[model samples]
Target: MNLYAHYVKRIQDFLIALVVSIVLSPVLFTVSVLVKIKLGSPVIFKQKRPGLNNKVFTLYKFRTMTNKKDKNGVLLPDEDRMTSFGEWLRSTSLDELPELFNILNGSLSIVGPRPQLVKDIVFMSKEQRRRHIVRPGLTGLAQVNGRNNINWDEKFEYDLEYIGNITFINDWKIMLKTVLKVFCKEGINTEGLATSEDLGDYLLRLGRITEEEYTAGLEKSKVLINR
Candidate 1:
């Protein structure tokens, strides 16, 4: 971990998060109500995500899926449980508003690498482990670029690039682009998966569709996600 990187980002994050929390309070309050009414009880979904130094921190997002299960007592996949309203919320990024609280709580920054789950950590290579050196964020270079449209190798490349070249200017650039991406519903998901192509399974099998196949597949997936 870089000492300068830690100190600089911490100070900047504190100030920005404070202001955003203050300004977004009304929107937050309103969304909480809508989530409760339309979504159900426990409007927010809190999950443990790996943060800076591989520490676990609770991540906040609006509940977009139901608790329904099949007769066998197995939960359904995201595609089945995700409601139309949930899809709308995700497309507009309304589902992410609760993360302002995460930013306020010091668990997240407004911009950084998106956090991965505990299970997802097993997928990262040693070289990719450096991403844990900084706090996870709500949006990042990966989010602003191709996001779920890109493969793991490409996403990791963008995440590492963010760590190496982060600055106030870069953060603002990503922020502005994120707003546009949200409106356009870009990089939300590929055709088949609602979230992403689970990198864990892919890496475990060392089985990403092959370089030649992947190049073509990702191009098609990119078009699908942006749509």
Candidate 2:
């Protein structure tokens, strides 16, 4: 890989995120107000996610769902907490606006593999673990290709492909495609799902994980998600 592509991309990500955040300040303010009214406090949904080399970082995003829990104290399903306004924000890709800070801070790149939950590491194969060789991105190869519509295996394939072909041109191409995808709202999600299933759940369905392993991973996921 070119030194510029690997080492200097962080500078590019910082500059781009700075400019984008400045330009989008008005929209960010508006969205913050709306989220406060609609989803209540903490307009930003902060979560721990694995970044480059599997290091953990706090990822930021505009909150789009209410924190309503069920009688059992477990959180409600994403579909249930996701209001129409929230869905609109997601469909427009506006909910990701806050992640510019993550890019600017060097926890993420403008283009790479999108970060998954800290607990999601349990589900990765040895090959899938290669996705974290580079910094996570705000928008990535798999993102431009299918977003939440594709399965976990397909996502890892795209991620690994991007890693193998990392270059300035490829990154820019993915960014441009991301813009078009956002405007068209293509692949925002799969049918009847607010988001893709958990990686552990997906592996369980594929029979790649034993029932006990899946349960253990699920517990870990809950702790990570709620932490």
Candidate 1: minimum summed lDDT over ten consecutive residues — where? 218-227
Q: What is candidate 2's CA lDDT for residue 209?
A: 91
lDDT per residue for candidate 2 within 61-105, as digits (tens), equals: 999889889999999988889899988999999999999999888
Top candidate by TM-score:
2
After superposition, candidate 2 runs with Cα above 4 Å error = 219-227
How accurate locally is residue 113 in candidate 2, as Cα lDDT from 0 to 100? 94
Q: Flag clash pairs in model 2.
A: none
Clashes of each: 0, 0
